[model samples]
Target: MPKILKILQEDHRHHDILLSILENQVKDAHLTGEPDYDIVSAIVDYFLTYPAEFHHAREDKIYEKIVARDASAAEEIGHLDEEHEACEAFIKAFAAALSNVLGAGIITRSQFANAALEFIESQRRHIRMEESIFFPTALRVLTTEDWASLDAELSDTADPIFGSQKEGQFEALRQEIMDWQSTREPANDHVPGDHKLRL
Candidate 1:
């Protein structure tokens, strides 16, 4: 596996954990009637910034090269860039909904819950598609030279949450990830029913 792919997979792992945390928080909010807006905001803020700024761009670089190397691979790749755009839109819309919830505006708990679950499920599905379809296609078709070119061309941007220089701004969210990781039993990459909420 190329280093870039490994990094992307690691990013997906971190994202899965965060999504689980978000799911747990959303469930709690549904039950308690009081949402932990700060934590929720932190998770939303992290998604809004990190994945767009660093993660997807890296994947796009690789995906572009794969298509150039083999046009047939394009079918497997299949609108991933558009999906990235959609993911960004998801985060932005979720952030706006979160703002409304925080302000105690017209957004109902049902609306907020729907937005949160949509973002979480969309993200999980995207990652799964990339891992299943995209990454394997890249590995099969891309030559050693291709990997070398991609490795040289790609920038080494440290992830804000999981990277070595972890940002202090994400301290609360980071702790939530850690606590969530510690408590959960080992499970498959695809967490079935994890996103289900009581509404």
Candidate 2:
């Protein structure tokens, strides 16, 4: 596998961890009739920090390169790009809703719970499309030279949003989220009318 693909696969593992956290929070919220603020905040932080900055940066750069090389891929790449934009927008909205709940204390716990659930659903679908369709297509279509160029580009492209030294910060943030998840009790509680915990 190319270095970029390897990074992306590793990222998928992290995304799985995050999805688990989100599912757990949703389950706990429904069963306990309490919002898991820590998990919620952690998700928001991850979206704002890692996903938005690092992962998306890599995806955008690689996809842009692919499109540049193969004009026939323009349509597919465009659709994928739009999906990326949609995911970013949803994350921002979800994060804003979370902030409103925390800062203004206006939204009910139930409302916050719904928001989290919706965010989770959106993420699940987005992940499926990327992992199943977009990534596989890229892997099949991109040549060894293309992959090499992407790797080189990724190394050179500094994430301004994450500062110049982003890799270290990204790893640190990932560890922080993992440590938090490890310390928390498994969310097995069931809320009325809500499905069983899937985490």
lDDT of each: 0.82, 0.66
Winner by lDDT: 1
Cα lDDT tens digits, model 1, 51-109, are 99889988888888887888878876797789999999988888989989878678888
Query: Which residue pairs collide, candidate 2?
Result: none
Off by over 4 Å in 2: 156-199
Shift of residue 97 alpha carbon in model 1, Å? 0.5
Task: Give the clashing pairs for model 1.
Answer: none
Say which candidate scores most in TM-score: 1
Q: Over the stretch 107-177, how does candidate 2's per-residue lDDT look in tens digits?
A: 87777767777777777777766776668778877889888887877754443222344554345445545
Tell me each candidate's TM-score.
Answer: 0.92, 0.74
Q: Which stretches of candidate 1 lie over 4 Å from their true place?
A: 189-199
In each prediction, how many residue pairs overlap at the backbone (N, C-alpha, C within less than 3 A)?
0, 0
